[model samples]
Target: MSPKYTLSLWICCCTLFISCSANQPSEERSDYPEADSLIQAALSEDLFTGAVLLIAESGEIVHHKAYGYATLYDESLRVVPSPDSTTTRHLFDLASLTKVFATTYAFMALHTDGKINPDAPVSQYLPDFNTPQHRTITVRQLLNHTSGLMPWYPLYYRAAGSDDLIKEILSLPLSGVPGEARRYSDLGFIVLAEIAESITGMSFDEYLYDRVYSRIGLEKTVYNPLDKGMEDLVSTSHGNPFERKMVYEPDFGYRIDVDPDSWRNWRTYTLRGEVSDGNAWHAAGGMAGHAGLFSTAEDLLLLLQAVINPVSGSNDPIFEEETIRMFTEPDEFGNGLGWAMEPSALHAETLPQGAIGHTGFTGTNFVADPNPDGGRIYILLTNRQHVGVDGAGLYPDLRELREKMAKLVFGEQLR
Candidate 1:
């Protein structure tokens, strides 16, 4: 089948499944007028081109709504178009969610089966990491971003070629003593990828696909969309801020447009059938502990449901109950394994103390509150980066929309 036809068929199948499931109605179908109103307001304000917002309570999908066009073009600059409907299944560059979906989850599975010890020195897996300073870095430190490795060091720049990337990464200097402090580091996850590979004797992507995604029925989630016949569902964008236009580096090729001024030619570099992150693309978009994974809002919700009910439909939990607790619990820095713990000012009232979730740099955010009687999950996916790359305030607007929806659903002030 053609890539476009495959995606169209997948979207149609999911939509039909949802419609059939909804007709059978359970606890999830309870009226949520306020939630509906909030989503309507967001769509009316043009905050999102298209979104699939679902709310579940007591193991039921109570609210599911799709809005906006799958594709919306800007006449002045000819920006990449957005998806027209929730069923359209636009590809979302998962950004840091890779930390959880790719890295943390992998480790959890390994740790659960006794394949790895969190406190063991990383050198045990990757022997090249035997430098005195490196020998002390434990798997636990890497999981918590306290590995003392610099947050990131542009391995793409240091490595002479793709084959040398791992060598260059192994030679990086430690930024601090391992386990001394918490500093979110992409490099940490990159190293974790190497460790996972060494221990499993399989590619990182293979391990995740066969173990995690397939088990959860996450058909649309994968390390790289290009590999999975997802050429059509992918979204494209310009660099942020609209000032720093994208520039092609000889080594890294095309950048993802994180600065301003790139918005005008955003479509020129529209990454429809490619990975957006230069590092991931250069690495061929396989599993990376740091980034790389494309999925839609509905697929993500399925993953979250698995997180909530780890033992449901599967005997093996994605994370041990303890590990899941650690991923959701806040550290001294208020960040968990791959998620942010604290609520923004906008949703502080609605978000409980133990609420856990993550935000993708590409205008995607999800929050799951496990407050038992009143817990709710909110997912908002957009391509605000499509408008401008360097823009920093887009999240606040997204948060406000989520707050509004929460307030409407719960019938109280969420902020």
Candidate 2:
């Protein structure tokens, strides 16, 4: 379908929702005072510069709030954070969330359209994996991270361009036999991105937006926010010390050597609206399957709604409910196609099994409960990287915060 036609259809759907009582909000507002307190505490401690927290219960938005500042530091003037600029609509670099929101959706769309088979060997499309075992890696294995691929690599330093990057990813030796382990491999998703592009004969970003997100009515999610005329994004990272400095310096001509322990004389210019992931920004130009999609909390809710339930009555709905369920259902390893299954410490232990979500390195997460008894979705977006990479290592209490937020959202259900 054409972009124009899909947009018009989305507008019609929005109008329909607004006209009906389905758009009317519930009378009793969900209280999340503890959640608010946690955000304030995080901000005061400089753990996160800003965040957008969103909660959806039974398809209705209950809590949507923004906290702190988007662009906190001003290196030019050496001034402290100014919060007058923070807004709920600010775009955030959703680090690894790109796996589920973009790459997974693209894979699902191709499967639904009969353009690709989940069980087929990825080498069928991208034949660079010429070895016996490598050639046998199925699309399902890649999605479930059972492709025996390495978890990650310094692709930014290794590859000269996008083509070289994919080659570098394919050249990595298998960590184990495919389908034997549950290693979460970014390399697999990188290959999956290539598979999607190879199948559709389009760029990964183009295929993702044109084929998946646009059809599902996501207007704010994008691959390269700055390139697409979007400013006002949550800040992340101080500078690319690893890739840009250690590998290719003049852009980041502030470091002498690659030392994870060294801290003095480090470049501290905050990354505002720029991707923090070295592989995605430096190698892929802010477009990659493993990372580098920017989106707002509200934009994500649209995609979550489609995932939590079926998108019915539309001619070009992105994927069938059955397809979504199939993809989200846990495999033998307790891993979904792209989602991280719940009963995780990320959510309340009392919540039923089968809750699913993914977390980003930039302190962003979204989780949804599949059980009908407590059907809810929660999104927490934080630019925790604003304090730089070392900050994340130093303050590794994010899991604690997530657990608290989950408990607050789930309320007395945990009791």
Candidate 3:
């Protein structure tokens, strides 16, 4: 492989491909025709430059395919002279999916070992949430997105380091009353990580790997894949332009209360192997509970097997059925501890009722149809940011594609 370069993200407009068929023929056929067609349509629409899809039924891989280029365009959008074809092995930023496989799984592991209690106050684990405003919040509520925490904030702008970031997050006022509403708060998950760290006395990632991942057969599933000698990852986004816009442009819709000028540091380069989330990269230093995980569909399936089928392949099940169900069964709030219960955007209409799943920014998804007899695990990993955002300064939305995938995987099950 030729040496890769990390060039300025906003440098140039890449050679615009009219469609994903620019390098490959759209007429190509695969065993999984519906999935192939869906991805091809998405690629033509510039949903992403590359993607990998894997479907496993009862822990058995049924259909696994890769599409498009791993590094189709450079930071400036100029087409790469020799872009690498995406493969199942290439890691894609799992984004918010990290909340499930890494952080949520961390919670499940702790619960299984009797080291943690979902009903317990988070303040008991991390003093950061001990304030009266956050005192009533429970660990389960954080997992359920009912902690009343705001959906997001750019804490990196205000904090000096990870510790300060945690403090700042816990210090923030709530968006609603705790346990009374469901607000998907990344800060809540960040606090969840703080709780995990305080209990384990290890870095969040280290503890997760030690307690759960290491026990299972997840090799490529990891935090900071770049430092682990994983350089050939699917590219994601042209720098943090979208995040910057969120701060600099009030109407961008993120609407953080802080001044945009507060944070001087910004990444101006295209990302590869590096995390795509501003919080995970800038504030949490490449690893956090809410985001910043990298993995391939192949490796993630191993995790699915352990969580769903109780078949760890080469190891013991990561969590018992009871523990897994506690985290997978969503309450009235439509959240299962760390997982999102079925009927969510990804699992809606097609997946079995009460199944568990999660979606990621940067175009990734993990869903499992938790049928008692047999289940299918659906994973779609894409580099939605590789081609850069459209005129609206937004990455292409893959929710429609995600929904289609679930429908494709569960044809007659659609509601």
Candidate 4:
């Protein structure tokens, strides 16, 4: 054959190979197509404004995809989101995941350092936590959500600030005796944060950064994202309308109302770069144990990856293997220390029996096995509440979208 003809033939062969490879299902995408499809479906339904979905298996990232808009509007301009207009780098309110990432990790540090006892009563460190009913609430009980504290109270409405809030929480009566039952409680983690402060002589955010984040290679994870000038942060809710109504409306009698959803007045202003949880923002001033922490999905996945591998993967391990085990192990309620274990909705329908994870109220969640060898991690971060709480009321099934995502990822392995 002539030299030109041979070169042309080689070029044609290369083009055909490229086309075939492009059409082939990626080996890296085992269950990712189903998972990505689920995310797209959720985005189409406006289940969330935007999301950063990441999946890793056997210590390698198999999938990392960003979707939808970081913000649908700019001031007054309704901008259509594209790759240039939107990014996965936007910070999201981690909400309750702060329990594990900040509060729980702080406690684990305190426990490892012998600075605090897990079994010790809260009163041991905080003697003013001397409410008769709360004297028996141990640190372990708080960590495990067995402290019998209510899941939440509108302390932001009742108290002027953190000082008064702590006073109110310490004095509040327990709904049940300590260790009698497991009830997931923000109040418990708030108290845990307080306990951490009492022990370290530093604020929660300061202590968390010094002890956990600063050392863990998590530079972007932070509290008070607005203070850090993170203006592009993913927006949540329309100015906490439900909370404003509960706090401000005179018909509610200027008291903490029991039913949050059954209220009259609601705010319409957009809540961007603000902590969505009322108590965390208003009462604690955007620094709390249970909520307030904000981070990117990439930052969170770094932390999660460390938690899974713990030993040699990161330059500094977040926790020792034993401590990690203790935290991820199942409790009576199938909740791990700060993490949720098997049978929790966060773990999806049919994940491995020992998979552990946690979900944030702001549509953030990460479920991981952390077995090192065959471990899998799935993370979804979105500003779902941006559509307003009322949207969920109209579209009640919207909340189940995470579980559906999990089911899709796990496929037939889900129980």
**Leading candidate by lDDT:** 3
* Global lDDT scores for all candidate models: 0.62, 0.72, 0.79, 0.72
Which of candidates 1 and 2 is the stronger one according to lDDT?
A: 2
Better of 1 and 4 by TM-score: 4
Instruction: Note the clash tally of each candidate.
Output: 28, 0, 3, 4
Decoy 3 TM-score against native = 0.90
lDDT of prediction 3: 0.79
- Residue-wise lDDT of candidate 4 within 1-415, one digit each (tens)? 8543453343334322322343222332333777766766676555665677778777677776666655653332233243122355668888898998889889878876779878888899998866667778898999998999877777764677888877888656676778988877999999999999999999988988888787777878988887887766777776665556545565643355445544433435566777888889878988999999998766877777667777765565767777777877888788788887755547366577678788888888888776777777788888777645552232113447767766655654444
Those runs of model 4 whose alpha carbons end farther than 4 Å from true positions after fitting are: 1-31, 73-84, 244-268, 314-316, 345-347, 391-399, 412-415
Indicate which candidate wins on TM-score.
3
Residue pairs whose backbone atoms clash in candidate 3: 14-77, 14-78, 237-385
Candidate 3 lDDT, tens digit per residue, 245-331? 988898888777887876788887778888989988888889899999888887787777777677445455667789987787768
Across residues 154-224, which tens digit of lDDT does each residue of candidate 1 receive? 45544544456567766766778888898767778888888888899988888987777888878778766
Window of ten residues with lowest summed lDDT in model 4: 76-85
> Lowest lDDT 10-mer window, candidate 2?
15-24
Candidate 1 residues lying further than 4 Å off, grouped into runs, are 1-48, 74-76, 79-88, 160-162, 239-268, 284-286, 314-319, 344-349, 371-374, 390-399, 402-415
Backbone clashes in model 2, listed as residue pairs: none
* lDDT for position 146 in model 1: 86
Could you tell which candidate, 3 or 4, scores higher by TM-score?
Answer: 3
